[model samples]
Target: MKICFITLGDIKSIATMKRALGMANPLQALGWDVSIIALDSEENRSRISIECNENVQVHYYKDCSAKEEVAIKTRLVNQICPDFIYFCSFSFRNRIIKSKLKHKPKILIEHSELASSIPDNKGPKKIALRLLEYYSVYYADGLLCASRYLEREYHKMARQLMKKRLPILYSPYAFNNDVIDAARILQQELNERYKNNTVLLYMGTMTRNYGLFTMLQAVEQVTKQKPDIKLLLLGRGRHLEEAKTYVQQHGLEPYVEFKGYTPENELSSYFDRADAFISPLNDTVQDWARCPSKIYMYIPFRKPIFTSKIGEPKEIFGDDGHYFNTNQPDTLSKLIAALADGRLQKTDVNIDEHSWDQRAVDFTNWISAQYAVRFAAAGSEVFS
Candidate 1:
């Protein structure tokens, strides 16, 4: 069998990109041919490389502008006629591909809580997007939800629609152990500088909805009582300036360090040095549909985690680490300081179940099953 995997970014970096890459490798290992199509740019093509020896090939098309990007994607779909096309997010490209393909299987994976992920809108743009979303969800052969929560939400919204037959697959984010081990060694070196201080690391994109502003305030509160605590924020986003402002306002400048836009290659080293990982994401309708990608990264380090009661993290951990109410700085401060408590140190958050390799293995089986069922349904003519 041949699978043509498609997405909008580099297959080696973004969470969805890496997951697609993971999907490609195992399928190839099982003796299937695989090809990946991404937003083919000169910069991305030059920087990224697929590791598979021969079974897999990566085709990059130069998309000069946003308009050109769509043109290139259309061209790739026409060229690579594989058994199935697995893609992330919904767009004009997916719709065009589905309409054009004669007998190809296509899976449209929802990476976020769609209705909630969009910003608060009032203009014509909001109205247009709402309509676009309705069609995108209705037309796909299969709808893959990143978590069970999203699947439930999807069903609730489209219960009356005929699209119920679309298979809802859970596509969780994953962590490669080899990557974790390498990151641990690098983290050890970084930790040497803050040996006397307890380093609290916050990984992933720093955004307003991420509750970094509130988390920063809580850090300020914690530092006032325990001056030995320090914070290292390791990602960049639109709200970075706001996070800096929170630090300044709370006089946390002395204790907090802003390490912006750390590459995925260098992330593990930062994770290694962190005495504890904190993601006090705020509770919003958006967060309720979110699947925290950071949790997969932090669990393998075997250090305790600090998070809010939002979406899948609470269910996944279930008292394995520390949990706090969202937006409550006093409670958050207590949770951060509580990590140093002797009892919390020994609380083992079981990460073996959450490993990327395991997730990939499960996904591999699921993909195979999807193929088998569809192929069987299509009868001898389609398989041949």
Candidate 2:
């Protein structure tokens, strides 16, 4: 079957981009054709080759007005003529989907974070998003749940609106196979550089929702006892200036450093170099909705993973992850200190078991089974 992935974000800059790329190679191996459409960054539309193989065709248009953008998407939709169109987040196919595509391809929404869960989205904006989300959830042919919370909540949501249950595919973030060798090479370099320090790594958006300030606060507390401890933050977001200010006010300049958005290719090395991984998510609705993409990415390295005890990570990680019940920075401070002091132990996670290739295999098998079931009930005419 041919599937087209439509993303509204810049190429390789969002979760959906990675989700599409992670499953592409495996899907292709299983006799599925893949194509990608990027709505933002005209330069990146053509450069999709950098991330995907030459076999995967790409589509996009140059800078244009909103009306022109809609026209371009409509034309591109007809040209590809895919059996399925997979997308994610707020905008429906980056804010445009055919009134009806040529093939009537199925729509799969890979849920990330919902606006209602966000603290900033309040009043009329939140209500509007709820309406949009309600329509999007029921309108799609199926859902691709990123977190356990989303899968459970949205499944119930869909059931409340319709008699038939919507098809679901649980595809969380997985490690990149391509980065293994590069990560190994970079690990040795990082080992030599941070030999004398307690290095903890964090990679994600620099927003309040992701717990940027909470992480820095933990670093500030840790620095009091372990002056040489280091927290390397990779990625920049809206809270970058605020994070810097927190570090400065607390005199954590020596302990905390912002590395700024590291690309996907270079991330694995940084992962290997860290003594532990830090993802301080609050016990908020947004946190519950997300799968903690960084947590899955960190597992491959088999390093100590530190996160909140709430949601799916606690259930999935088990002994593998260090969990904290409190949102207090002091609670995290103790854990970091324990790991750095060799008190808290590291657990090994089977990399092959959680690799993207493995996830893709499960994802494809489920998809194939779903198609077979559909064909059996609707009589092959459904597939066409």
Candidate 3:
């Protein structure tokens, strides 16, 4: 079987790229030809490095303008004629690609919370984009969701468009084991620097939606009892400066370290040194359906987790760690107190269910089966 992935972002270090590559690796191992065609941007082009693996080819179609992008994509589809095309993140380019390729089975995968994430986005431009998103989702041959909550929202939206059901599949975000190893190395190095303090690591982009400020607040509260609580924050974002200022003003310079944006290959060591992974996500409408990919990385270390009860976190990490009230610094402080006393269980969450290799194998098998059924029904010759 031949599978081609169509993605929204430049196929670089983003979770979209990671998950696609994770899925592709297993399919390729099983004798399937997998290729990724990404919308190349200067930002991603400069950073993306994918060594050509056997049975897998990564292609980037570079067109700065949207019109040129569509043309480039159309040409690639015509040339490749892949049996299956998985679209990650809805786009106008997908409409063009679907129209140009009459026979290819297109699958749309949504990773974020779409509907309630756009309540105030009711202007003409927002409405137009939502309509496009809705249409692409409703018309796809198959729909894949990263979270069950998001799947429920997707079903509700599809029903509004007279679509009762979509051939929906579940695919959560995941990391390559190689990347996990790198995080372990970084963790050891950070462990040496912070000496005695337990490093509470938070990876991924630091932003308002991700609850970075609340983490800082939790740090301030925890320091009084557990002065040895050191925070190692990775990744950069719009809210980095604000978080920095908060750390400085609260006299947390000795306790908090902002190790901004490490490369993908050099992250596992950090995961190794982490005593706990913290994500204080709130119960906003946006947070309800979203699944942050960081939890997957945090789990492989088997370190205890500290997070708010939002989205799939509760379902995935139930009783494995401590859960705090979103936006409540007091509750976070209480959790920290319990942590110092070894009250929270350090047991591993059952991430065997969320393993990247398992997820990839399942998805590839289902895709192959679906394609076989379609081919047989259409009276096409099947290959042994």
By TM-score, rank the candidates, best first: 2, 3, 1
Residue pairs clashing in model 2 are none
TM-score of 1: 0.86
Q: Candidate 2 lDDT, tens digit per residue, 170-265?
A: 667787666565545566788888888999998888887677877888878888888878999998888899889888887888888899966555
Q: What is the C-alpha lDDT of each candidate?
A: 0.67, 0.74, 0.69
State the lDDT of candidate 1 residue by residue for 1-384, as single tens digits: 556767665433454655656556655555456787766664345434523345567887654565666666666767877766666666554334456555655655555555535566547776776666666567666666767678786765566566665666776666666556553546556767888888889877778667777678787777877888888988777888977887788788878999986655677787777888887666665676767777877888878778876677767766665787766877878877776554455556567778755765566556656655222321221332
Worst 10 residues of 3 by lDDT: 372-381
TM-score of each prediction: 0.86, 0.89, 0.88
Query: Hey, what RMSD does candidate 1 come out at?
Result: 3.8
lDDT of 1 at 362: 66
Candidate that scores best on lDDT: 2
Better of 1 and 2 by lDDT: 2
Best by TM-score: 2
CA RMSD per model (angstroms): 3.8, 3.6, 3.7
- Tens digits of per-residue lDDT, candidate 3, 1-384, equal 567776666543455665666677666665566777875676444334442355566678765577777777667767777777776666665434557775665555655555426455667867786677678666687777888787787778778877765666767776566555443545556667766777788887788667788778888988988888888898888899998988888899988899897765556677776778887677776666777778877777777778876677877865555788756877877777676677776666566677777887677556656554322322243543
Against the hidden true structure, what lDDT does model 3 obtain?
0.69
